[model samples]
Target: MIKFFRKIRQKLLSENKFSKYLIYAIGEIILVMIGILLALQVNNWNEYRKQGQKEIVNLKAIKNDLQHDLNTEFIPGISYYSKKNKDLSRLRDFYLNKEIIPRDSLLKYFRNNWGEWHIILNKGAFENLKSTGIDIISNDSLRTKISSLYSNGYPEIENRVNIVKQFYDNEFGPILYDNIILYDSTHSHDDFDDLKNRKQIGNRIIQHYYLRTWLFERSELVKSKVELLIGDIDKEIERLDK
Candidate 1:
């Protein structure tokens, strides 16, 4: 192609048609410029396409995080807290209302249901987006929503759970060890029926009920938010695929 163009230029120059040669030269320059522009355009398009694909991958990864939490973490958390509340309610019945409940059942509830559900979120993808650039998300509303959920919503729940965990670790756990026989349900504690110890343990169970109730509501809200976000991400993915 270079040789052909060069031959044409030589022929035009040799003919001494200066006006025609000037026109041909100008046209050739325009063609070269056009070629350069087209190449640059194609390169720009390729970059845009790659970035778009990356955005899709990021969205999918985020969706995976949300889905995993919804199914495994949040859903289970909601159920766990609900059960906690119920068991605490049962304990409250016996302690507060003086309901005649069996010793074994009460002990089982106290011993087995005494744990907190720590929040285990998958923030890897979100952190990756932050590391690269959150603007990579493209959608303004989605970017804001996601940032809010991770930075604000998720953290709020985490803080609540941490408080519950701390209560168990620092305060309530020792009380349980002192007032309740955990390993052996049949073995009663020295102060199991003492008025002071009964009130203390009863008050703790009531407080636990409230905390678990709070956590359950929060879990439900976060789960709903995650589901909505997943839907939005699915739409974005479909749009990008197009």
Candidate 2:
């Protein structure tokens, strides 16, 4: 094609058709420019397609992470914290009313009441997205939501959990260790009866109640955020599928 165009230009120049040659030269330049533009457009289209596929994969990964969290962390966490909160509330009521519960009951309530929340979010895809470029997500709203969930929502939940855990460890743990036979798994009725008579036990029960209440509230908040994130992920996934 280049040779053919070159021969035509040479003939035009030799025939002294300078005006025609100029026009032909200009046309050739326009064609070359059009070709370059088309090539660039095709390259851009290919890159867009690749990014779209990558976005789908990332969205799916995020969805899976959220699903895993809902099943393993959020749902179970909500149930566990809810039940524990109720138990602690009942125990607090007993302490306030000066009512004596069975030793096994008290032991049961205290044993499973406290738990550490260590939420492990699957942030690999998110991190990659952030590092590579947020534009890869395509959808502005979805990208914003993803960013908010990872940056603000997750960190808030983590901070809340850490605060509660620190309070338990630093403030409440030592009191139980010092005053109660915490290590005695096989606690007798006498041990519980003795704990009831201790004046400081009421304060400890109150502290436990407060902690459990905080935990329950935090668990609910985390669950809500997780649900919202899941919804956004589903929407993004659907969009990507199209």
The candidate scoring highest on TM-score is: 1
lDDT values for all models: 0.83, 0.75
User: How many steric clashes does model 2 contain?
Assistant: 0
Q: What stretches of model 2 exceed 4 Å from their correct place? A: 98-104, 114-117, 170-193
C-alpha displacement of 78 in model 1, angstroms?
Answer: 1.3
Relative to the true structure, candidate 1 reaches a TM of 0.86
Ten-residue region with minimum lDDT total, candidate 2: 112-121
- Cα deviation of 220 in candidate 2 (Å)? 1.9
What tens digits encode model 1's per-residue C-alpha lDDT throughout 1-242?
Answer: 99998988899889988898899899999999999999999999999999999999999889998999888899888888887777778887778876765645667777766667787888998999899899999999999999999999999898888888887777667778876667774634444456224677778777777777887788789889999999999998999899
Writing each residue's lDDT as its tens digit, candidate 2 over 202-239 gives 77668767866666686677678778878887877787
